[model samples]
Target chain A: MASPVFRGKAITYGDDVNTDVIIPARYCTSFRAEELALHCMEDLDPEFLKKRRPGDLIVAGNNFGCGSSRENAPLAIMGAGIACVIAKSFARIFYRNSINIGLPILESPEAAQAIAEGHEIEVDLGAGRIRNLTTGASFTAHPFPEGIRAIMAAGGMVGFVRARLGVDAPAQPGRERKRSQG
Target chain B: MGMTIAEKILAAHAGVPVVRPGELYFAGLDLVMGTDVTTALSAEVFAQMGAQRVFDPDKVALVNDHFVPAKDIAAATLAQTMRRFAERYGIRHYYELGSSGICHTLVPDEGLVSPGDLVVGADSHTCTYGAVGAFATGIGSTDMAAAWALGESWFRVPETFRVIFRGRLPEWVGGKDLILRVVGDLGEDGARYKALEFVGDTIETLPMAGRFTVCNMAIEAGAKTGIIAADDATREYLKGRATRHGVYHRPDPDARYARTLEYDVSGLEPMVACPYSPANVKPISQVEALPIDQVVLGSCTNGRVEDFRIAATILKSRGVHPKLRLIAIPGSQAVFRQLLYEGIVAVLAEAGATISPPTCGPCIGGHMGVLGPGERGLFTTNRNFKGRNGHPTSEVYLSGPAVAAATAATGKITDPRTLMG
Candidate 1:
């Protein structure tokens, strides 16, 4: 509620971290949230799911999310409670998807190399700061676009849309939009 | 005052009169798409928004190719979710593991797209459809869901750049190399969001497969789509296909483009897109000597049967290098059967190439031949971005299937031209 707090350790990687490896082509069938979360990073480090803790930050090189543009890759990581991602750069599609889902993806070349895996860290969006609790290092990431930040502040695109229309949340298995005519 | 083919299409879809370049036109989208990941989340968003119906189910398509053949329990669940959403929405076109190929190829091949239409897919390479002369581009999944509900989307009318390939291509120089050279000339992102129209006699001579290869990498240059006017070749390719959809035409002779660059195809040698960027291209001669740990020959870009036949001929009686792991993935089940029937599969198998099911496999860094740390790979896929095939330190070299096959045999980069000789 308070700027969506994120507290976790960090995992590091270089540029062009594609979605296929993050979620894998094999696990594409699973739709359950819990199920998808379990397969995060099965390729880079088979033990990643076992070893990762909630609120962990994934640090990587440029062009993160370079191929396919699958949303599952980001969902799996975020659903696993990854606090945020800090990369040198990100693919155009993945970057926008992360923001729409209310996941924080920070870009900073220095921040990519500043933290080590398992090092407790906190990301404060309001202040645009990343606090490495273990190393006592603080890094700054560019502020999100105002419109994007507004969506994230509301929790995600769905929440933002609902808030924009001043409508009550609906509960249903699979319903269509009343505004579909637009 | 000049307009590009992309500009012409966007103008028609813009709902406004006379769209000019550099003007932001929030044009309505004719089609919006989501694959495995976005489909599930978008359904939830729909539920939260109390939406009872999509704007138009006919315009929506869903496919599960990202995590095909479900490597793990979680991925299988994601695929199921996408399948459920496609079914519940009555999405007319749905592709699963057995039916799925890369989304870019699947869309056009299934006849879901046509020229002059504006389409947006939730994947970057969605630009592939631009080969058909559609003003198609990739957008975020969230953007796609918005379009699903509203049937509208925004765009900035882009300027156009003309790429003209002239002269005859050497036998071994294929579409893959042509695009690589294009990427080399135009730095990655050089044409970001621009429309690219390819011209010249060389383009006329190249087959549809080669045209697709060039269009497939339009995204690498950050172009909205790469297009060539549909000619006799286009008519021939579309002749037997269902005529229910697709638009084809040649650009107006007076059509305006922002800039034009020309190249000679015969002068082109095999090229590779080095790690971290598709634009980082080098001739095969420069990198052909580097030892490789893997060679992959498939993807939407170069996974067609013609690519395989070309590779098979190069691989006949040749064995994979002892140190190289060569993986061959047919683009689709159709191609797989063709290879099987033609005995091409047998020859490839005898050459020590590991064959995988017809899925995107390893092209997007998925399962089936991910390179280990510091490992170098020569692949026929479109991209060679850093960490694209597993280890960030691993090097990926993008090439034509002929080049991949040739390199697999020597364990080092070798020119496909020599193999042809």
Candidate 2:
């Protein structure tokens, strides 16, 4: 598989930016991804929608997605054109949710602390390497395993599972995987 | 190498002799859950996956608690989608509006969980079942969708944090206080991606309902799950409900842990998480007398009968303040019926509390008791995040039943002990 890399300017925030502010419950009833992006971070940083450039990445302290299991948080972030998130840590469900949705996230307390807002950064997802171009700093994160990278590369679990069940270009994802419920 | 009970359950499901933290393993799920809030999206994803059917009907539970009784067209549509999916798939565990409650409590109450089970749900509070000694964790809708197709999902074995509680719990102080104290001490991210194994003399004597409360908020501290070994207390609770015997597991004496801490609950008091963060907890005595506009007494967290009993005791003869709108929600239909049979609902109603049907309505700010702008609410629910209950300008403060009941009576945050005395 080819190594995937992401480059973006960092938009930094402090610790414990929970999921509620990411996509408030008022909007949790489910809307199109682009529609949800309009309100992303409306509560925490009303400026987020205006401040974010396409391909901008979020850098934050610990527990970046800390409350609620609404998958909307990651979807909103991804829809907002954020390339990835570099944080000190993430709430467990949020971490997996991001992966499942093909939103790349890396945990690097070192990079998260040192990178200033608007600093340009580069990440090599396959190698787990981070480069802070502004500060000339370098960091390492535990890279995703081959299987997870494959999932993300295939545009997330939906597409990946479709491929796995041998459902080809003509049909839906995995008809061969089906069994009668009892 | 010794392993925690969570580790043991994961290993057994993963078809491995042992497991280590941070390594990915695909494990079979004993159960999977979705709610009205999540299932519509999951059903969509499952279709997108092109799977023709669910992995197993018996292992899946679809509960319409989050926004049920059809809060609006959108909520009703979600429930309708879930109903359609359940009927199409021949799922037997579908709990519709009247039968539904908070998915976390409803799953356990229905005997769907057993010791050593591996469970996942689209909602974060799924970890509540770790009280039954299961390795249960919350996953996203897509993950649950995949599980419905494949009967399993991959997981990174979490490191364990052993919390040993000592000393006796004082009156009006129970699992909610203890877990809040744990959250306050650990900070919101202290246990990120890790299992919080609760063990101590205090937990051994705590009632099953209290144990459920403690594990329910594991998400507040960012724990993968909060677990307790199923013992006599667990057996007593599961006696006749569980059709199959659960695999009782015990932590190896030498199980490795990321951290081990001791909490002396003997001196503990009723604690509350102030506005905007579950980790921002303060003992009731130390907090200011912040007046409240509303008080909510239930959710997946503290909606159990025991919780109602505690709150009913405090609000029994005392009427709520005229300015306060006190709402009580039993966690499930079963709990609601119990409260009704015990005449607790009558007592609550007479005391100016509105007794609502069992649904997760107000907790997620969906409906039932939404706060208007500038209003503040004291809740026994988890996650007091901004805009969590209603208007963005509104605030949410979290407590257990005792504090919720007492605060409703006074129209301000008050220590339940003071009211009791």
Candidate 3:
């Protein structure tokens, strides 16, 4: 797979952006990614869903995604077409969930502080380099482990595991199983 | 190098001679729990992964406590999915609405978790088990599914934060105050990805229920887990209840800690976490007399018999404010039975408080005592995040049962010290 570079407009937020603000508990009934995307960030920023563009970047202060262990918080971000998240720091579970779901997140206090809303930022996943086009400034973060980078490159843990196991895509419920016939 | 309690347990589960902080290892789980809201999604992921059967059905517990009795059609359907999965997998520890309580309370009460064991639950409050000296932590649904499939999950061993409480706690101050103070000092994310090892003379003297309350909110500090070295108190509580016995792991005397925090509780006052964040803490004396519309004295954090007993004592001869609605929920069927047997339930009922069955009701905004718009609630539940209870406009103040019961009687946030005097 080729190393990918992403460039997008920044959407900035304050510190301690909890999971409840990203996606409220009331809307957690569904597991479908896109269904969750509709309400993403609705509680904190009502305009997030309608205003978000494909491949938009999210930059936030410390403790981004701090509350619940709901993976939907990151899934909602990805489903809303966010390219990556850059934060001063991230809550532990949120960081792992983002990686498992194939959302690229960089921990760069310098970048988070320098970036502003509507600024165009470019991130090179392989190189760990970030350039703020609007500010004409650049920063670097620790690149993800090669194993983690590969998982994100493949779109997530499920895809990576499926590929490693040499299995077909997840089967629909109604499909006939070879074991049933045997 | 001396291993911390968390490190020792992880090393045992990983089948490795030793493990250090920042090193990743896949550890086998002794127990994997899922609630009604999260189990359904985990089951879907398990099926999607094309796994034939659970690695160990007995090790998994599917609890139906989050939205019991089905608040809505959607909740009912989600619960049904959990039921189907549990039955299909022949999972041994399936507890439905009436038979179950909150996952954190029911798991330990039912002997599903034991000291030195590694446990993972889909709910974030799973760290509650760490009070018993187990290495327990919360994971997402997909991670829960992976554990169900492989009987193991990965972890980066967390550095330990040693918090030692010195001196006796003041009257009316307990675990709730201690944890709130630590969280307030550390900020919400102070211990991110770290293990909080609570130790000291004060911790050793606390009852098992109070210990659970302290560990339950470790997640509030962004901690991976909270631990207390198993001792006589833990052994006595686990007597006849734990499936396994014998040597439980404890931290060595020289175990390395990322930081050490010592607090003296001799002069501590009851604390409250104000609206919007658990980190917004203040002494109850300062926030006293703040009007409140509702009071909830239940959750995995403080719904035990001890907590209810404290509330019942205050409400014994007092009538709750006519304008206020008070709801008291025991942590489990066992707790409810104890409250009934001891007449605590009756005291609460005579005071005009609604006693509900063991469920995560109102804590997760499911039902029974949801707040209305512009309303204020004083609760004993963990987490006061915006819109956590009901309306986004509503505010919640987190407190212990003593304060919650006193507040219910006064229709405001009142100090229990005043009422006791």
TM-score, each model? 0.78, 0.95, 0.95
Clashes of 3: 0
| Cα deviation of B417, candidate 3, in Å | 0.8
What DockQ does each candidate score versus the true complex, computed on alpha carbons? Answer: 0.24, 0.67, 0.50
Task: Please report the TM-score between candidate 3 and the true structure.
Answer: 0.95
Better of 2 and 3 by DockQ: 2
Candidate order (lDDT)? 2, 3, 1
The reply for model 2, stretches above 4 Å from the true place, is A1-7, A127-129, A133-140, A169-182
For model 3, what is the error of residue B167's alpha carbon versus the real structure, in angstroms, after optimal superposition? Answer: 1.3
Task: Write one digit per residue (lDDT tens) for candidate 2, span A1-182.
Answer: 57678888999999999988999877877745787898999988899999899888999998899888889899999889999899988887888789888888998999899999999999987687889998899999766677677778888889877886666566433643453331
CA lDDT, candidate 2, residue B97: 65
Cα RMSD (Å) between model 1 and the true structure? Answer: 5.9
Q: What are the C-alpha RMSDs, in order, of all predicted structures?
A: 5.9, 3.2, 3.1
lDDT tens per residue, model 2, B33-129: 9988888889999999999988899999999888878888877888898999999999879997677788888899899999999999989989999
Model 2: clashing residue pairs?
none
**lDDT for each residue of candidate 1 in A1-182, tens digit (9 for 90 to 100):** 57656887788776556676677644555534467788887766678777777767888877777565667677888878787888877766677678777678887777777777677888886777888899898888876656566667877777766664456646443545544544
iRMS per model in Å: 3.9, 1.2, 1.7
Q: Score each candidate by Cα lDDT.
A: 0.76, 0.89, 0.88
